[model samples]
Target: MSKLSTYVHVPMENRITVTLLCCASFVCIESLRKNWRPALTHLSNGLRIIESLPMSMLNKLRDTVSIYGSANNTEEELGMDYILRLFATWEVSCALFAENFKPVISVKLYRGRELDDKPLDEFESITQAHRAIVQYTRDIFALVWLFRDHQGDDQFWSQPIPRRQHEILSHRGDCMGGLFERFMAKPQAPPSGTGEHYSLQWLPPTVYPNLIASLGIEGRFKLWAEDPSAAPGRRFSASNRATTSKAAYEMRSAKYPYRSFSMKHNEETRHTYLALLASDGRLMVFENEQPENMSEYTPIDELSICTKPSRGEEVSFKVRFDPNPDPCYNAMQAGVANDSLALVVAGMAAVKIYRSRDVITTSYGVAQTQREFYLALEVGVHRGLVRDVAWAPGNIRGHDIIATACQDGFVRVFRIDTPHSSNEGKSWSTSELPRYENHQVQTCSRAGQLNDKQQHQSGLSASLAKSGSHAERHFSGQLGQVKHACKEIAKLDSHRTPVWRVGFDDDGQILASTGDDGKLVCYRQTPSGDWAKSSELAIVKTRMATP
Candidate 1:
């Protein structure tokens, strides 16, 4: 048994309304036999949940599994982790997949060409370049609609077309038209120079293969694929054995290099995006590819799925952080903002910040994301790894506050007090490494940006980097690696064990940090605007072993 809340006060059979609203709804027309109460109840319950601005039910559930995952916590010791995921995933996932029910607002994709008038039956063939997908959040409850090819009906699983009915009609080898297998092959990078253009519309993509896996059955069209009857002429895989084929999807959904932390919900504007950081030293940005949603800036509450999406070249929004000077990190953290928004990502020993070129006047503002990234600071906390980073909300104050958790058993607060540069298309200068002794202090400043003279020197160094292993071996044997540090406003060394996470609520008023001690410490801003310890929550209760 676990801690659970019974939030649904009304019975599933109760209707939301039976009067004037019925004229516009099909449910009202069909109200003769079926009880629309459950659906309405869900609608009411969902709004209540969204008011708190929580992560997607899917991500929150994933968070629990993350805490107890093989690489993180033990199931026996962290039984609590299963509680939240179990309840949330069951409720939301069930409603999402419920017969005739929808959770996603819609998903539209860009294939880099004019699309066929009819909705696509399946993903663009392995040969076509599939570049982006748009996600729209509907104003209604949890349900969402999707049109993969930008020219279809609202329904995803069926109605407009059921492509999943037979994605793989024939079997040739180990893969039955495994679309994901092809995804592993690096598609040519989006044609260069289009960098700034695409950056204006979307964020840097994450490792796509793993993201596909996380989509579950919906990802690779497994809904009907698993059913032998769905495709009568084709034979199912041997392991599929009469509808017990979850193994196909289970094997595909392994850990993504950059897992999601949080995303602005549909109630938020289309410009708000999904923020993720990779353990492998990359920041991934995802935004709706909607052409129409691109034009509006509705408050979070009024925002919903776009009724239409387009297949045009001149669409999207963006940013860029120079390839890592050292590019190594144990974990990562990221935060997103609105109105001339600012994005900050940090990990290992580095912290990078990106700003929109200007505030968006319209509803959708992904276009504001710039390819130019400001290397705000480099952090080196006693040569320790950073566990987490967070930004406090304040357009008035311009998001200067940051909180970070570190392996050094401390939670640090940092302020972005510098006028950083826009280092677009600039690779960190590897040529000047040997010129300085304290690499941390040496490479962490604005001087690191490459000007004309430095660019020439960088060319020689970059040439060496591109040169074969022999050149790398020669350079490695001669010059050493550089270290860097970003300044912090304050450091709180309260935890005895390594601090694992740190964050600020939407308001800059409260700050919280969690650690291996199984305790959560919270700090609140004072009347005078100073953060002070306010509360401590015990995650793992002191318990005796059972027989």
Candidate 2:
């Protein structure tokens, strides 16, 4: 590395040769005790030299290597490959370890100089997955930085943590029995009482259809064939399911690509509804169960459900269904009907909840009924763009829990509490609203405004009322339409970078988040009703070299 640094002022051809040798040496010394500062310093200098080379010269070199080096596998080709690989590895590592550290070598700098493509293998698949994860983190970090610049402090999180029926999180670590038991092989012993013996054998791998290739991220939805336990060999088969169903074909070939999809099943009606978030900022909902011989179907636009759109033109991030069967009844039973369900959609700096509403109308002496979704609540306490949202599965606790990842460098956990279902007869009247001293008014609501008298009657102090006269705005088109109440119980800022994703354990006991910092953080509620960090795993800032 030191030799490479000294050669930075040498002739261009000599500098390239020396830098290549330095990179090869740096990658070979793959010891944990080795200092990376010198390697990074000299590598940056080497990349600068390469970046300054003329494109025509680089192209001519590439052509020469392609024509003659294919047969000999020359040492020069191998050295160049090592240098480029080291450059990519250090570039991604520096971006993940520090905040806002720009890469020294841009994509255009090495546009046609990347390493040669190799056949798919275990190592190749792992390398691709790692690159995808890094790209996702950088995208989320950029989004968060853009929003946080214009954002101010939020008083909604400043208030004391309110008490709720679901304040305590039950521990589920013991439910897994023992950690080692899961990985150990089972004994070949028969049951004491039952006289039946079962065979345990590995099933053959089943290959699926290939996905369509595209420039941007694209996904396809397909349903696999049912298990064939009684087949000749008792193995699953995809013999007749080589092609997707008609509905799946239409969805895959749609005009807009889908970012995410979710499904909800209704026990009473025995029907399932599929929700899709399009890349173009549209929400489409369709009934998953279709006729066997149906030749035509309704377009997704006509089947699109209602949503509380965001003020900005940002694309929708994620759409999720409340895992609870009756989220509406559990959270806002007082106002919503018994059969309604909750659906969550996250977008730019906001997460909104919609509830199913059935409307019946009679026109020209005919009666018709239609199911539509209406915005029930909107949680905009996040100071940055909302990246992901997760709804915890229903548990013994009476309230519903939601976790959101935001660009504001925090993973926020909120509990949906209703005075009606959680605690009978404990309702929040319109006249007794909580006071917000530092509440921001400009982004609160763009549709409605409250006068002095209304603000005063909302139980705000004189000073608070004066500062917040225009603070009570709704994202659902009009004010006073949303009656659902929710509170942010915990804000986990251990990531200290834009969080990309958040998820809850199966039992909703443990919440985990990950982001640009390359750290996995898990939170559990403490006895004092506050969320505390339970464990953290750091995955960034490490070098992996093959011997």
Best by lDDT: 2
lDDT of 1 by residue, 417-535 (tens): 43323431223344332222343343333233323223222433433343333222211211121112335656676677778777776566788998978888998766754567889
Give a tens-digit lDDT track for model 2, residues 88-155. 45655666664554454434333332232222222123233344333333333333343344345455
Candidate 2 versus the native: TM-score?
0.49
What TM-score does prediction 1 earn? 0.33
The models' CA-based lDDT, in order, is 0.36, 0.51
All candidates: TM-score? 0.33, 0.49
Best by TM-score: 2
Off by more than 4 A, model 2: 1-47, 51-216, 226-250, 289-316, 328-332, 419-482, 538-547
